[model samples]
Target: MGMDVYVGPLTRYTLGDWLTVVQQTMQAAGREVRIVHAEPEPEDVITDPVAVSDAVRSWQAGLLSALGSPEGWTDEAELPYWTDKPDWDGYGGMILLAAYDEQPEFRPGTRRGLLRRESRADSARAFQDAPAYKRASSNPTKYPTLLSGVEWWLPVEVAPTVFEAPRVTGQPARMGRVDQLVVELTLLAKRLGLDDDQLGQLRQAGPPDSSTDVEAAGRFGLAVFLELAHAAQLANQPLLLDY
Candidate 1:
């Protein structure tokens, strides 16, 4: 299967909000939401438009919660981005949180914050350890253009991804600062195999696009990754990857 990778924090909306979105989306597709009621002796397949809508909505809500709610912790199965076979979870062994609507802040007590913190420490340490030390970009000014599509986020208490659908065709969705950082990290981790010294050079060098050396290009991304990690921790957001 082809993989689509997304890096960002969860959205902060309610379960009802997502249910509404599901209904609207279904309606727009000219399909009515439906479910079967299997109680009270006779098992019946529900198709009354309003009843079907309500039944499907209620069912979806249950599914959302059973999976994961931003309001509470979910088993790995409930986590939106989690799969038995994850393509990547190498962010310093931290349990990455995918979006849920209820909780707006990063969950406490995880090593997810280590990457940025380490990057920051490395930045300061490098210069002190060596006068001419190059450092990764601590605070990058811009982000490379992300792919054009509906970006997703976890609404506050919802388990489903909220699509940030573009208003105009071919127009790109804007990513949050932390989201940008997550993407940067994902790319660097996947593409670069630099040592600490190379990373230090990347820190001092500019963004990847400007670099001619192949490794430096990768390092540019690593620099962005470090900055994003710092930003994620500062904002109390999780660095999540969706593949």
Candidate 2:
């Protein structure tokens, strides 16, 4: 699977708070939610509400402790190592399984699992290929290849206060704030004829013709991001993204 990136607003809330948000969001939509523990015992699922909440709270604290913010944007030495399973000293994965009446096997699995699954399905990038800075901002443009679509100005360099992830690991991680994300996204969105009305339509209709044009793909990816950014701005949170 290719890397998929996401940009949204960040929240001051700890992982525990986000879990509560997830639970409440799911419940309000009228879906069944369960927490699964897959070790110490052979069991794969835990339906008890209290047990799940406690486990999630403990894991959140541990995760926060393990992840201390990096001091500088381009300081590669400060990047944090990543692991597939950050269970906070637990063998079992803390998963949130959801299902509606029509869909039974709607298992998103662990929070990270859900992010990875969605990124794969969506094909979003942590950073778009467009130039992050004006042509004059960097070195001379004599070598056009240096500004290839694959390259980008690190979010930390452009918007350090917003991006909190220590580094870009293989998995989803925080990148930049919504205000900066929107600004970067707008560069491509405007060139592709994606105005407010079009963005709104794309949000409603989902991604359209994303495979045909790079700008279109960026536009499609931002459809969800616009909403997420708005939510983050309201909640006073920073954006999380990876590619």
Candidate 3:
């Protein structure tokens, strides 16, 4: 399966009217608020939106605090909107990471091989041969920045981790900074020789002809990510990577 990106309130579609009511309450309060509820049953169809909102806010607050609460933080009442759906899977993500890993500029303690050019097949093989935990991005926490963590409602700022609480059921959960991710993604796009026009074309382009075209798939995935990251940054909303 592929990944779907989103930026806005968490689970706004699924909770429906319940989410609306809770969002209204949050807006009216004009300050941080929390709602408590009993644990839900396994077969429970309708979840308590208040509890969900509370969990989301609690997670956001803790993450923001950890992030030092960068500028442009806000509590806006906006519905969740689909950003982009990349035609790639976890392995595809690994492929992108592998490509970045091959770049000498991105590597640590070395500046050699800056002019080297490798094929997409080489990147695919690199991913296949490399260990699971590869230093593809400049994340201090060693997490795969864009494809794994969640970007909160704040301006772009880098951090090791954002959220401390358990993951929200189906919402964007892992904490991340949109700005730093943009920097990393932009670097990757440049390394692949993908310009703005090329990125836009790749964003609309279909998946690669062969899954073996790992570099093409990686470029397509990067295009989708850059679009969504920019949107999330501009809107000051959370960027969800729904797998």
Candidate 4:
């Protein structure tokens, strides 16, 4: 139950179903990697209760279409463990789930990817040089550029957090593996400073993530951490993390 969702660099056109691709890619080369889908949503949350439903449908379609493209960080090198035949350089992408007050609906489910025009464009630029602004300023069409779109609400758990959002509906998301998810989120325990007794209390008490009436608070604590991490990134702040 501890988890945090993050968006990272990816290769051009390597966006759709990347969880499977990354999993299979790592496994084929005998590397252990953790990846998971982090999408948070209330089964029936309506930001504009009247328009919430319509927005949800539209958001879902946008996410699906966005995922079809690819995400990338063309500037960095791949991880040391990367043995995949294809060079992992300049490959980056992002999947945004919801910022929920509860644990994601399930271990495996869809969440939201809140994409504001500014944030979407900002993220996309991380992938490719906005050709027009290149250092050379010569080849305009030589647009060695990356395009960034966004994924909206994906279907998943109906948590209490859903109702708390300024606009309750859907959000952004990510994909990978169950193990990676646990590690990604649990690592924050160091920052959370949970002692043995404190851990117990967190699990037993604290505010729920919004969905399930009751679940250990510690589990959703991780989800909250994940949400905060995303908020930081979208704001252009240091991502407390990105592993």
Leading candidate by TM-score: 3
Sort by lDDT, top down from the best = 3, 2, 1, 4
lDDT of 1 by residue, 111-167 (tens): 344542122111211122211121111212222212211233222344322223221
Angstrom error at residue 185, model 3: 0.7
Candidate 3 residue pairs in backbone clash: 150-174, 156-179
What TM-score, over all chains together, does every model reach?
0.26, 0.36, 0.62, 0.22
> Compared with the true structure, what per-residue lDDT tens digits does model 3 show for residues 32-81?
43433333334654467666566656655766565665543453335545
Off by over 4 Å in 2: 1-13, 16-30, 33-174, 207-217
Cα deviation in Å at residue 199, candidate 3?
0.6
Candidate number with the higher lDDT (1 or 3): 3
Ranked by TM-score from best down, the candidates are 3, 2, 1, 4
* Candidate 2 structure quality by residue, lDDT tens digits, 16-116: 12332334568899985553422123244444445554543454344345444232221121122111111111100100000110121222221343463
**What ranges in model 4 sit over 4 Å off?**
1-48, 69-182, 190-197, 202-243
Top-scoring candidate (lDDT):
3
Q: Candidate 4, TM-score vs. the true structure?
A: 0.22
lDDT of 1: 0.31
lDDT of each: 0.31, 0.33, 0.53, 0.29
